[model samples]
Target: MDQPWLKALHVAAVLLFAGGLLAQSLAVAAALRNDISPGVLARLRQWDQRVTVPALLTAWAFGIATALDNGWFGAGWLSAKLLLVVALTGLHGLQAGALRRLAFQAGRPPRGLGRAPAAVALALAAIAVLAVAKPF
Candidate 1:
């Protein structure tokens, strides 16, 4: 049996990770609009590198561990959740790369990158609903 505390921790981490991604998306959207201060953009890049990256790694570790412990392989819903997680992970990578370019390169913000966050956000919302409903 999985420890209750471990399950709780995993859920909390998931919420934090998802919420952080949403917040980061909004921040990127804001930055994309109108000229933002160099300091602000630089700080956002730094935060992504220093904080968001680590948090995402930790969240994935915990989430995967919890799923495994809960017999995720036996559940269709769990499999779907894992797939969505992978998609979100890809989006996270794209976001990180975009931030790096925005901070250091003089490029056109990498065309179509802006769509990733919204896509991930929608996927996440669907994932959340699936998790809650477990309608598999």
Candidate 2:
């Protein structure tokens, strides 16, 4: 409700989203060895819908509102952080689409999907540093 609480919620959501992505990525990568298992994909679907999607939405909503409320748009640090966040969000989209394909279309995850977890981890690290250091 309040700004501080909202910011806390945003952080929590980001953490949950990141953790879910890592878990899903691991599941997907493992699934590639023997084709996507229906059970695993089913679990992934539930996790994404129940946790990842909501967390992503909540993070963005609270983050955008906080930035606007504080008028930090013009700051160099904020801009850098936003850019990284955008990249991470794009990764989220890719992961979600892959999950859907595996869940519905019985698609095999491409070999390239294996690299996603690493990307997310690195992006999250960079975003954390930018947020903490606020370096230009």
Candidate 3:
């Protein structure tokens, strides 16, 4: 593929991934607010497993491809953004762990687990802004 088209697709994938995370964060908040039925929670988990996970994986794959194609390196803003992305990925794993634990516990979800989604959302928003502005 042409470099420009590849870059565009990579950016689009990143936007979709970040947007999906934000939507999931909002859904988690809503679930916490209202009484979340088991069926709804289960469906949400299923959606995350089926949709969000694969989208995120694809986004990361495309992002790496773009970076390699473009020779990404030695830029302060890009470095910062990459670090933030790593942090966001770690938070995602943490959130998944929390969800699994909650599912097994068969009790109310831990309130602290809420922080993971919120933090991931904030990080993603920051990454999006930085990507657009590229402020060092």
Q: Model 3, 44: alpha-carbon shift in Å?
A: 1.4
User: How much does candidate 1 score in TM-score?
Assistant: 0.82
lDDT of 1 by residue, 5-54 (tens): 66677677777677667766655666576456667777777776676677
- Please identify which of the two predictions, 1 or 3, would achieve the higher TM-score against the true structure: 1
| Residue range 1-136, candidate 2, lDDT tens digits | 6889878888999999888888887776776676557887888889889999899888999988888877878989888888888887777777777777877766777788788778778888988898779787
Candidates ranked, most accurate by lDDT first:
2, 1, 3
Clashes of each: 0, 0, 0
TM-score: the better of candidates 2 and 3 = 2
Distance from true location, Cα of 81 in model 3, Å: 0.7
Task: Quote each prediction's TM-score.
Answer: 0.82, 0.87, 0.77
Model 2 root mean square deviation, Cα atoms: 1.9
Angstrom error of the Cα, residue 18, model 3: value is 2.2
* Alpha-carbon shift of residue 10 in model 3 (angstroms): 2.0
lDDT of each: 0.71, 0.82, 0.68
Candidate 2 regions with alpha-carbon error over 4 angstroms: none
lDDT of 3 by residue, 49-113 (tens): 87767777887887787777777766677788889998876656655554554456544445655
